[model samples]
Structure formats: structure tokens, C-alpha cells
Target: MAGKKRSFGRVRKLPSGRYQARYLGADGVDRPAPHTFRTKRDADDWLAERQAELRAGDWSDPDAGKIPFGTYAATWITERGIGASTADLYRSLLRNHLDPTFGTVAVADITSARVRAWRVARLDAGAGPSTVAKSYALLRAVLMTAVDDRLIRRNPCRVKGASSAVTPERPTATVQEVYAIADAIQPRYRALVLLAAFSGLRWGELIGLRRRDLDLTANTLRVRRNIAELHSGKRLIKEPKSAAGKRTVAIPAVILSDLSAHLTVFAEHGADGGVFIGAKGAAPRRNHFNRLWRKACHQAGIKGLHFHDLRHTGNTLAAATGASTRELMTRMGHSTARAALIYQHATAERERLIGNAVSAAVEQARKQAPGPNGHAAGT
Candidate 1:
């Protein structure tokens, strides 16, 4: 019989000094794989170990193990659409920031150092800290899914301090400033501003208001839906952000009267029973309202005021009326007491005035009573 043929496979050196083993199987199929070793002996050992595993039917293709971060991220996003607004934001970030860097990198190769470098690059590219943090969060979430899928051993994004520090932008406005802005606005938008300032409604919530949502007799406004401007040149009506957001707020008597007057005068002829329609009775766009708001502010000589500030103004005024924190949270649909405190802080001056009144009352009582004596009458 002829001697058994040698079964040694061809070996090639990689640019990284690692050797790749290429071999023809008994079935005449060719396979190529990385040995992940520097020395020839180590490579040979790895190859022998892998061949034995193949013989034992326990071999796993190492190349097939590595999944590109971009591919995994896309799959995760498709599987879980976080929310319409959040998904849009994530898509923008992936297209503009993440895909460019880690799109081709293997999910398993994504180390904490690599992630930190990416964050540094983002900051070097003049991205804000908050933008960088959000990007990191998105990447981290994708990698976490990889861990769950057994594609990666660990998520590098979970490293402490991997996310950049971001300063939160202030989101509050004073009541006086909002009123001054409303007073200077054109008559068409005046009621709109008043409605926002008094109702604590979001921009979408205000624009989505139908005539039926308001009850003048009952002095209540039910917030059932919100209208958003989509990329499709038309409005999309969506449910409110939370269950608490779909609440019925008691309209102040003043706001009810204004709404009754506005309906009879301006919005009565609009289609769709809209309470605040644009010119020619079209569904109002947020941009149109924002532009009008800005122009009104400019004319009113008010600075640093935004249209959303009207909601803040409403919260501040409500807090000044001695509304408890719970009441304020309920009215504003704030999921946490921390958010309600922002509005309460805007009324800090009112708190100081109350403090002064209490101090004066204490001083009066002290003066009217005997000092250091148990006297029944004034000394």
C-alpha cells in the first residue's frame, strides 16, 4: 500500500504578524482561518488544537464569530423602534457620527479605549458634550444587545465615565416675561400665547387642540392628542407622551372667556374644528407659530424668550398660587418631583416674600407679648 499522504495545510503570515492556516478537508473543501498567534510554534499548536476540535465536531468558525458593529446596530434599531422622535434622533446620529467610525469594526473588538477615542474625536469635531453622550448611549445600547445575543463577551460602553459630562440647558421662563411678550404680540397670536402660558400645554398639544376638547361651561380642556410636524409635509396626530399627559385640566375662568371669544372671532371658520388655525384656515404649523412668537418678542423688546417658555410661565404662576408640589406635578404631567422643582424654583421670589411676611408676623407677636415674663397683659 502507498504511504499515507501528509495532511499538513498551507500557512500564510498576516500583516499583524499573525499566521493564517489554509487547508483542504477530506471532503475536498478549502477553508482559511486566523491562528491568532505570533510564533510559528504557537500557530502550529493552535492549528493542531482546532483540527482536533474539528475531528471531535466541536469546532466553531472564529471568523464567523465577529459581527460588524454597524450591522448589529441596524438590526437592533429595526427590532426595537424606541419611539418615533427617539428613532429619528438615533438615525441621525448613526448616519452622521457612529457609522463613520465603528461601522466596519467587529462588535467583539469594540473596547473601552476605542469607544473613548471615538468620544474624543466627536468632541474634537466640535460636537457638544450632550451630543457625544447621547451617541455613546446609543452605541452602548447596541453593544449590550450584542452581549445578549452572545455575539460579544461584554459591552465596552458600560465602563464608568465613558460618557462625556453634559451641562443641561435651562428650560424655564418667568410669568412676567411671558405676559409682556403676549401683550406685544399681534392679535392673531395673542390668544395662542395666552392659551399656552395659562394651560402649560406643549407646542404640539396646543396646536392639536380641537374645538371639542374645550368645554367652556365646565371650564376644562382635555388633552387627548398631540400634532407633530412630520417630514411628509403633513401633520401626524399621536397620543400624548404619557398616560398622565392625557389629562383634563381645569381652564382658568380668564382663559375660558378668551377661548370663547377667539372661537367666535378668528377660528370659527377654520376647517377641522381647530381652535388655532393658520392663515386661510390651514392647520397650524409649529414653525409658523414659533416665527410669530419670535417676531412678537422682538417687537415687545423681550430677549432670551422662547415659545415653549410659555409652559414654564404657566407652571411658575401655578406654583405661586400655593399649589402643592403634587398638584404642580399632576398639572404639568411631570413624572418626577425633580422636574416640578424647576418650576417651583422659578417662584423663589414669591417664597422669599412669604418668608418676609412670616417674619413680620413673628416680630409683631413678640412685641405685643411680655418679654422674659409670664404676664397676662401688656407691661
Candidate 2:
């Protein structure tokens, strides 16, 4: 039988004398309290809480929020529509970081406290800061989607600065060291080293370059695509990572001659042919090049340097040219000014040189003036 109406919601007594509470949801669908109550007052209290949740706009679908973390996470990843490399990275994160702890937990059950504990446990397990940050970022993104899907009221990723990775200072090669390493490499790859240290192009971009990408007379290379090899040995060719990555960067006058020589001697035929190829005329993979690069570095006495550091050297040298941040971004094909800022900051050695020059200028100025300790011109 129907019972009395309350200020919040209607409560009715069932045939078994238990009370049932039902409230009209903000979604316009009437939903019952999660369970039956022994007393009318108990049912009324349950309805009151539901009303408050609705008023606060924190009410979510009870059924939808019950989805398991792993199930929803998989759905979220599929709906993201990201690139293949990015998809692989997210899958790796799920497999390595998230699934073990949160997979069975319901989305609604996730709390900020649990998230903090996860981060602490990851760090204690020897996970690096960058790895943890990336994992946390992926988790945050997925949970944000859950919030949008109305599966959860709020995201549990409350830790600030947990989404950004902190990288150690990258070591760069000097121009002389670059040349020494280039000279130590196979003659076919001499131009490769010069272009890497001078152009700021990434490995994928370099390996993706074709004969048509270079404008020899104009002394420029057009960056349009990139190629990456997955750990599973699958190779993917895709557009540049960012809009700014597709750009035209000029080659140094000195590198022009060497590039010309490389093109004449080793470049494969046809416009679509790769500008850089391995021993068998196939595009060079990073693993295959790693062995040769290690040998060259060893021979040049710069064994600790990674090939990616050549880009740092190139950008730093470009900054030394007094290029503006915008110009640096364009030349370096960086989407943000942060990298340009890093390149522009003078090195400690350069700072010392600047200090010495300033001191010398001050001393010369003092000697030229009629100071108390200095002789006058007509004294």
C-alpha cells in the first residue's frame, strides 16, 4: 500500500512490513533506494541522502558506476582514437602499472586515498618518477572520461604535479666531438651525424627522410613523416607528431657539400627512395644502428652519448646564434617554447666567459678615466 508523502520522497510499506524508498532522479527516471529498510524512518533517511546528492549534482547512474576499472579502462582506451605508438604506450602502462591494483575495483570505489597509496607503492617498488607520472597521467585521462560518461562523480587523481615527468639534464655533444664521432663512423653515415647535430631532427624523422624530402640547391630538408619500430618488431610510418614538426630546416653550408657527396655516392634511386638506408638498402632500424653508433662513439672517445643528444646540441648551437624563441621553435620543429627556453639558457662555461669579458671591459674603462689610482692623460 502507498504510504504518506515526505518532504524528500514517498515511502511505502511493503506487504512484508518492510519499507521501500523511491525517489525521482534528476535524470527524470525514478530510482529506488539501493536496498529495503526495516523502518519507515530508515527508508526516509535513505531517500533524504539521495535527494541531497541530486541537489548537489553529484548523483550518477548507480548501475553505470558499478563497471570494473579494467573493463571501463579498456573501453576508454578504444574510444580515445590516438595514434598507434600512443596506443601501445597506454597498453604498456595498463599492463605494467594500473591493472594489477585497480583492475577489479569498481570505478565508483576508487578514492583519492587509494590513488595516493598506489603512487607511493609504485615509487617504493623502484618505479622512476617519469614512469609513475606517465602512468598517473594515463589513469587521470581515463577517469576523466569516466566522469564525462557519468560513470563517476569526480576523478580520484588528486595529487598535483603527479602528471608531469621530470627528466634529467640531457648531455649534448660539442661541435668538435660531433665531427670526431662522424669521422669515426662508416663513411656512408658521415652526413647522418652532421645532419643530426646541425638540424635537430629526431631519429624517426631522419630515418623517414626520402630523396624527394631534400632540396639540395636550396640547402633544406622538408620534414613530412616519421617512422618508428615497436618492440614487437612492427614498423609504423606516420605523420609528424605535432603540426610544428612538419617543417623545413636549412642545412649548414658545410653540411651541404657532404650531403651532396652522400647523395651522389649512396642515395638510392627514385624520389621515393630513402635518403638513409642500411647495409641491405632497407630503412635503418634503431637497434641495428645502435651497434654501429656505439662503435663510433667508442672510437671517438664519447661512448656515453646517445644519438638523441645530437638534437640537444643542434638546438643549443642554434640558440647561440641569438635566435628568438619563435625562430628557435620553427627551426627546431618544437610545438612549445619550453624547449626553446632550455636551449637559450647559457651554459656554465659560457657564463664564465661572459663574466671575464665584462670584467676586462670594466678594467679598461677604469684605466681610460682619470681615477684616483690611475694616471691622468695630461698629468
Candidate 3:
């Protein structure tokens, strides 16, 4: 007897009780898909659903699988066109840390367990908690993109308590310590340190400063651009991180006076009339500043002082002077009040003074009142 003619394209029965449907795709191309069912009716139903999905352009092959997490992340990074330095750092983190652990893994396959394991491995390899946390954040960002692309149903890295590692505190230098270090710096760079401490400019902002940006009349400096050294052995001027970062900061009179003296005596006078040029009248490279800053710190007998710490010192001192959180945030160009609070929190001594005043008031009130023993005299 002749077998019944199959109506819904060619079909093959597998030993595992699954039906394979081979049909011409919407593109008029041949395609095959598999569905497991207990009976021919169920298999036909599954095939019908798949055909509807294909007709609606919503069909996805179960076997097509997701792109590897690392590949998808790389594409996302390139498409977003992050700054060169940021791109380099992300790629380095991915290649050195992430790729090795999860490069071959599909975006859909990532789970909380996998992320936890990656974090533990990084920690075991002596990676700092902050570094691990950053790596995890990058990974999570990649997974989030995967979800957005519909490559994955959800981000697996959003597990609760995933980033609970204790991050080490960033070191900060006191005002006096910073002053001593500034004193030890070569006379030419004294103003640079002072600018960093008083004006709260980042290292790049200070280096990228132009003579025009300094309004000696107004005692202000406009942070228009930042100089960064590319791996290509050249310096590049880039815009500030945000619109707020490209603001004019009023310099303290002392720092303003010092900057005036430096401009008169030592500034190399760049072609663009930059203020902080090197010996050859070009922007000072980070290497030169790094070496000079370390030597100055060493001579001043100050340990753990970083160039960026001067910015923090400025913020701390400003906060100590009762600068409102909003004022400090504006001055520091902080994107959030949370970061500004870190600087405010650094003013422990000022907070302690308030605590002492409260204590003194309590003591005076207690002395003026009768004690539990009904003594009216001062105790």
C-alpha cells in the first residue's frame, strides 16, 4: 500500500519521537526545523505554530544559537565609539580578564553562577575588589546589550548581592601634606600642584589649559579641554567628560598669584598659547608629570600622594569650609551627589567639631539642671 502523502512539507521521524519539518523558507530558500512531540497531531501543531511565526517574521532557529558574549560585547563597544582611552581600558579588561573566562560562552548561557565564579577567580588572582567589581559591571553591560538585542531573554548578571566584595578606600592627602609636596615641587610646577589643589582640575585639565583659558582679570580658569596621551606616542586634546566639566572655576587668590608668576617666569608658551607646556613649548606629557610628582612627594616626605589626590584635597577643604553639597558638586564637576558626599565625608575633623559643640551644649545644660540626686549646684 502507498504511504499517505504528507501535506506539510517533507517530514522525518527521529528515534527520540521528534518530527523534523523541512520546508521552503519565506525567502523561497530551503529550511529545516525540529520539534519534539508525543504524536503526529502535536507535531503538526508545533509545525503550524512555527509556520505562523515564520510568516510573521518572528521565527528564530533554536539551533542558530547566540553570538559569543565576548564577540557581541566587542561589536557593541565599536558601535558606540567610546573614547580611545575608555575603549582601550574596556578591551584590556575583556581580553585580559573577561574573555579568558567567558569568551566562548554564549550570551544566553551566562548565569549568576558563571559570573560569581568569574569574580572569585579574579579575586583569587589578586585582582582588587574594585577591579573585580568593574569587570563584573562591564560583563553585565554586555549582557544587558544582549538582552536588548533579543539575543538573550534577560540579563543573567543582575543577581542580588553579586558585587558584595569590600572595595578598598581611595587614598587622599591632607591640605598640609599637599602644601608640603607643592613646596618640594620644582618652582615651575608649584603652580600646577596649586591649581590642582585649589582649582580642583584633573591632571588632564591642568595640562590642557591654555593661556586664554586663564582669565587673570576674573581669577578664573576655563576647563575647555583635556590632554591625553594616546598609545600612538602623541598627545590629543579632547573635550571635557561632560558639559558641566567644561566650566570656569574661580581660582583662589593665592593660586591665582602663583599662576601669574609661573606664566611670567617659567611657562614655555605653546604655539596655541597653552599655559602648562613642557621645556620644548609643547603640552606636558603624563610621564613627565608622573615622574616630577613622585619626586616632589618623595622630597616632601609624603607617602601615598597621587596627582589626582590634589583634586580631592581641594574638594575636602572646600567641604570643610561649609560649602553646600550642591556648591561642592558644581565645583568638583561631580555627576552625582553621592560622589560629592565622599568628599564631604572626608571632612571628619569639621564634623567632629560639630559633635564637640553638641557635647559642650549637653554638658552646659546638664550642669545648669538638677541631677537625679536633686543637687542644684554645678557638677
lDDT leaderboard ranking: 2, 3, 1
**All candidates' lDDT scores?**
0.75, 0.89, 0.76
Residue-by-residue lDDT tens digits, candidate 3, 203-283: 888988878888888888788898777655666779988777878788888777788999988775653587876766667
Sort all candidates by TM-score, best to worst: 2, 3, 1
What TM-score would every model get versus the actual structure?
0.76, 0.81, 0.77
| Selected candidate, larger TM-score, 1 vs 2 | 2
Q: What's the count of clashing pairs in each model shown?
A: 0, 0, 0
**What is the C-alpha lDDT profile of model 1 across 1-379, one tens digit per residue?**
2212336665666677766666655445676654356766675676677578678855444444388888878878878957676666777788788999999998888898898788889899998888888888889888877777656656787557656574765456555666677678766666788888887888888888888888889988888888877544456788887887888887878767667878887774534588877776777777677787788889877877778877877877888887888898888876678877776763567878899999997777677756576752354
What's the residue-level lDDT of 61 in candidate 1? 44
Q: lDDT: which candidate is best?
A: 2
Weakest ten-residue segment in model 2 by summed lDDT: 370-379
Residue 267 miss distance in model 3 (angstroms): 1.2
RMSD of each: 5.9, 4.6, 5.6
